[model samples]
Target: MDTGGGMNEHWQGVAEGLRDDTALLLAVQAEYRRLYERCFRDDPAVNHRLPVITHAFRRLGRWRVFLLLTPWMLARLLVPDEPPDIEIPADWRPAARRGAPYTMIGPAFSLELLTGRQKAHLNYSTAIGHYFLHPLVLAMAPFPTPEAVFGAWNDVIAARNANLEKMRRQNPQQEEISRREFFSGGFRK
Candidate 1:
């Protein structure tokens, strides 16, 4: 099914946008780090929150970046944006058909043609990535204002990292079990 001329350009634009967004996210993180270092030296609470904020920022940043980028990659391989238009036979008339009309469904996204298993796999991966990244962005955000955005960002990262590290150190055995489980099924479950 033909997706028309706009498909390629649309996906290309999306890919570029994703790349730009990723860069912006990284830059924002760097700025947050610099500010944290310069300003929050003596405060124990701020120190405690640093890793959390960074981890959260990285997580959300990574997922959004992936979400924005994956479509382009899949579009390149499976759909090619300009697929040949399907031609209906001259004698074929929908009203004359005995059964339901022949429905010609074109590609909405690259994954549409994939097997159920493959679609599930891709969806699972996307979900996992999003889960990791969304919180980071959320933590970093200074909601409802332009002034304390950076501060909010830093606070979230610091908090996330601090908790993450503590969890890591506190539960080595659990972590090992989780690692095993995670790898055993590609974390699909």
Candidate 2:
């Protein structure tokens, strides 16, 4: 799908990727396969396996940055800056909410489409999700609506917050120290 000058911007590096069989993409794809297997470890009674799905992001053109930041700014306005005052049982353990599945990965960002979650930020993210969800077919695709992705992502954030709470309890004194540091402009360079 060339768009005048060359390949469509959305599929820009893909031909090169396919031609060279990028080792990193291959490795990322393989690791996802393992995680996909783990997600269904309890389903030994079923002989069939789930299909892997792949997707690509639609091109954003000149409106990309505006599209990205508008929601972030709006969300910041809607959500207060102050932290919430809530309490949880000291012995409570984190549990997955019904039908909410997640995996923890180190944050990824890439300036170039060939690397990082920035690749997804700039392109159709179904390719990225395909590895995690293990869909059987991967076709040229577009990024889904932000609500579709981030709404579900709230679950992962909740899990992270629970773990952070546990850490705060374990090291209660550090909480005040960190708070003071933040309020006093002690950001690390």
Q: Backbone clashes in each candidate structure, one number apiece?
A: 19, 11
- Provide the RMSD of all predictions against the true structure, rounded to 1 decimal: 17.3, 18.5
What are the per-residue Cα lDDT tens digits for candidate 1 across 34-82? 4345554454433232231222222221123221111001111121122
Evaluate all candidate structures by whole-model CA lDDT and list the values in order: 0.31, 0.30
Return the top candidate by lDDT: 1
Task: Estimate the TM-score of every prediction.
Answer: 0.28, 0.24
- Provide the lowest-lDDT 10-residue window in model 1: 123-132
TM-score of 2: 0.24
Q: What is the lDDT of residue 128 in candidate 2?
A: 27
Against the hidden true structure, what lDDT does model 1 obtain?
Answer: 0.31
